[model samples]
Target chain A: METGPIKQKLEQQWQDLSLQLRAIPINPLERKWATIALLIAALFIGIIMIDALVHGINAPSNVETIDSARLHLSEEFAEDNLGVQTDGSGLITVRMVAGRYSFFPKHIDVPAETPVTFRWVSLDVLHGVHIPMTNMSTMIVPGYVAQVTTTFPKPGDYPVLCNEYCGLGHNHMWSNISVIAKEDWAAPVKSAIAGGPENE
Target chain B: MNDAAVRKLALGHLWVAFGAFILACFMGEYQVLERSGLIDALESSSVYFASVSTHGVLMAFVLTTFFIMGFGYYIATTSLKQPLWNQPLAWGGFWVAVAGVVLAAIPLLTGNASVLYTFYPPIQAHVVFYIGATLLIVGSWVWCLIMIVMFSRWKQANPGQPVPLAMFATTANALLWLWTSAGVALEVLFQLIPLALGWIDSIDPGLARTLFAWTLHPIVYFWLIPAYTAFYVFVPKQAGGFLFSDEVARAAFIILVVFGLPIGFHHLYMDPEQAAGWKLLHGFGTFVVSLPTFVTGFTVIASLEIAGRLRGGKGLFGWIGSLPWTNSMVLAVILSLLMLIFGGFGGLVNASYAMNAMVHNTAWVPGHFHLIFAGTTVIMYFAVAYYLWPILLKKPLFSREMALVQLWTWFIGMTILTTPWHILGLLGQPRRISSVVYNNLLTLSWDPYELAMIVGGLVLLGSACLFIYNLAKTQLSPVQDGFVQEIEYAEPLHAVTSLPEYLNDFKLWNKVIAVLMFISFGVPILQFFFIDTFGSSAWGY
Candidate 1:
């Protein structure tokens, strides 16, 4: 079979391969291309970092946990407590729950030109909600809360749709968000014990 | 050069892989049609989701696992010039996987396991589905074990010698799979299976997703390394030139294994389970991983250029035209790389931390993956099959022209299908929906794209059938009296006299993988236990 010659040839190939490996760092063309690739990768990371740190555009990663099975019984996510609320500081927040085929508080109203924090939890399975044409999208995983705070600059009616596959009624799972002018919206009365107006 | 047992074993796996692939193609076409709402009668979400679940499992898991196993077997035998390490154990693994597929199909077809392929809990499938899927993974573990054993045995027998590039890549993939599959294995064994079996009353979807995030990203590389192996070892030779650099190819495989595992949180960017810091960290790694693809593109293109120049083609772009277009391997790489360019761009967008919000869970996600996985990866799979079938069967090809046409149509069809899909994502269409029943002006705008996708699906289905037909004909044709061919790996530009151990082995890389995975995933997974969390009851069929 003349195995000696074949083995010698293979041994030569191995040495040449090692030489090429050594040359990679010193070879002008190879070094240049490697540097360019690294720089491009760094540039991408830089853009992402600037977007997160400077531009305030980051992933919706509010790591808040909740008892999803008892979400409806919770104070913030109670059925009657769902939808738009205004705090003492005049900050608007929308609390909602996503179930098999629908978002609780099926319709919502918020003031335009103001930031609204959406706090969503899933009652069962997993769901994702997105308000079309807006940066208001987050996954509603059971056992945790998904929160996204964004300002709707333009006042209009936007469809709040379930983007994640939930169940048989996934496509049917949607609601509406009406972003009204700030002046047109009325804040609900606070109880007198809470030191606020009692208008019905 | 393969023995009868090895040939039978390889063919068995390939047939199953392609069988699953062709079936999944039909389901893909049905999905686009149903989702489009163009056909009124096909409007059942139950049926649609069921089909989608089966489609994803078949194409992503069954087709890939079986095909990789088959291809690994052939590459191990032919390249290493050794008999398969354990013949009966290999067949045992194959049957275990087949049994799993059959078990899972029961639930998938009857709509009991319509949880989609991700099967994220508390959306539960039948207990049998979890068990079946676990069996499939367990079967692949056998293949992994066999590959590692053969690799070590060869190294021991021929000390200080460089392993064949093909076998080296196969062993790398096998090791990567062992690491890659562990995440899902843990998730299934502890979370999904127990929950489905009613042993656990509540399950944390957060922890499930975190574990899946471990497997999710690297598994793509597990699927892709073989295609890259072909690009490195087979394509250059097929194109009639030497490999640009064998050392560079080894480096690429090593980097892919190391960088690929710890960066899965890019899939979890929009999820609440992981913190922003971890997501950003993984996002950085995601971009870093693209370096190998860039190097691959350069090296492969340079090889093709050399081949073209050798064939007397002149000018900068003339090499592209002078490539052996009739050769299925050459034609497939050309098309595969073209798809990789576009798909890679889409992947970068998905990996972008803030930018992902625009396309997260949208049709764009599917579009990006289909282009990369189905278009780029599977196209290479076609080339490898076309290249291997005649050698395995000792017969001539049924139709070279038909194979070329199939490759072109696959590229064209994939482009047509995915372009509008990406557009639909930008237009704010959520993926995995059975029907678009919104009926608004915005929804109506998606109609033309949907129509285009239907045409694309039809073209892809026909192309798939042609691929199978050519291979089947090749196999069934009577063996030639004097058919003689040997698998040829591309030689490097210069012969080597010696090499370092790091480039020739995976022991160090495996350690590096462990450290990287721990650093990236340790706190994220551990936090589930430390934090106050709730688990949800089972919710779906």
Candidate 2:
């Protein structure tokens, strides 16, 4: 297993290669290319940073935790308390529960041209809710509450779809949200809140 | 070198990888067809989900782990010109991983563990799935151990010498895996396993996701590095050119491993558990990781440019056409790079902290990964297989024409499959669903894309079959007498007599990774424990 000649040949090849390379003038192309590549990456990061700062298009960061098993028992997410509620300060908050196959308080009514904060909790498995054509999307992890606040300027019926796979019926796990005119929304809210037979 | 033992080991691992791959390809086509709702009898949620889960596991875990392990072993032995450090241990690892895949498959195929590949908790899988996946990681860890040891042994033998670029890249991947797998290993052993076994009455889904995210992103790099290694080590020589720069290739690998970690929070950008600051931080890091890929694209193309010019090419774009396209390795690299450009653009969108909210967990996510992982990464795996089959078996390829067609079809199929997928994401299609039963205008728009995907999937399946058929025929053919061919690694035009220790060794980079990981992940993971968080009881089977 004497490898002296093989090793010598490898060393010779290295020496010859080095000599040949050194004889040729150094190419500044790779160095310039590396710099340009780094700049492109930096440019992307800068744009993202600017977007985050300017548009406030950040992630859902409210790290609020609730017990999944005890969610129904909680004061905020109780069966009777779920759906669109207008607080004293005119803050419209929609509290909903995402369970195995459906979102509780299935049919939701809200007003357009007003800020509505969505507070979402999962009673069982993980589910994600998204309203297409709007900045309303968040994951409803069982133990954590996902909250997103947005204003819908246009009045339309949007499908509240569960994007995350929960179980076999995941595709069917969806509800509907109707965004009505501010003047027209008050009547429906009253009817919707008045012990409407729960969609549970 | 008369290395029959190593050849057998490499061949064994590669066969298993390709085996899982072909099976997954069939499942992939079925999924598209089922999701499209084009056929009535093919609609079963239970079966669809079970198939999706199996397809994901087979492609992501089984195929990648076995392929990287096999490729690593072959690279280590051939590049270093030494036998495997521990042949028996390698065999043991192979069996362990095989057993793990089999054990995991029982639950996955039986519809007991249809949690998708992520296995995010609260939506729990069967306990056997977690245990089996752990064994697979453990088996890969053994391969990692062997690679690192071989690397060190070579370094010791040839003091201050620049290790072979192929071996260096392989060792980098080995180190990267050891660090990368730690996250999922911790999650599985501490959380998923305990919860699955009912030893823990309640588990934090937030914590589970956090830890899984830690493994999720870097694992992509773990898979990609082998492809990048081929791009550097094999492609240039196959294209008939010298490596543009050896030092830069090493630098690219180092940057990938170090920066690839600590950036997993990008995956958690839209989740509630982590804060926007951490996501932004990881987002910046994600962009930083893209630099290596850019550098790789530049270096490899430059190599090809040199190759093309030598073959009498002129004009700015003339080099592209002049390079050898019939050679499988050369053809695969060209196609792989083309996919990488598109996939890398998709990645930029995914990593943009603000833009990510628009596409997170949508049809876009799958579209992005399929382009990158199945498109760019796996195509090179095909190339490497085509290149190695002849050398290891001492038999010429049965059909070079078939290999070229397979490579072209894979690229076209992937493009066709992923393009509409990205479009569907923009149209607000949710991923991982058994079907689109919404029957709305938006959902209706998704139908055309779904139809296109089926066509794409069919093409890909055909291409995959052709790839396997070529390899099988090559291996089954009689070994030619006096057929001797050695593995050829590309030589750098500018080789060095002496190199900085940092470029040649992993000691410093390992420490750097530790510090970076601490900074990026420390608060995100630790916050889970320090906060007043409630755990969720297991829900799904």
Give me the runs in candidate 1 sitting further than 4 Å from their true place. A1-27, A182-200
| lDDT by residue for model 1 (A54-101), tens | 888877798999998787579877666677778989988888888877
TM-score of each: 0.95, 0.95
Q: What root-mean-square deviation over C-alphas does model 1 reach?
A: 6.1
lDDT of 2 by residue, B1-541 (tens): 4499899999999999999999999999999999999999999999999999999999999999999999999999989988889899999999999999998999999999999999978888999998899899899999999999999999999998988989999999999998899998888999888988989988888988999989999999999999999999999899999999888898899999999998999888878888888888888899889989988998999999999999989999998899998998999998899999999999998887767767877899899999999999999999999999988898888999999999999999999999999998888888898888874666877888999999999999999999999999998898789988788999887875666677789998898899999998898899988999998888773
Which regions of candidate 2 fall more than 4 Å away from where they truly are?
A1-27, A181-184, A187-194, A198-200
Q: Interface-residue RMSD per candidate?
A: 1.7, 2.8
Judge candidate 1 against the unseen true structure and give its global Cα lDDT, from 0 to 1. 0.89
TM-score of candidate 1 chain A against the true chain A = 0.79
CA displacement after TM-score superposition, residue B1 of candidate 2 (Å): 7.8
lDDT measured at residue A170 in model 1 versus the true structure, 0 to 100: 91
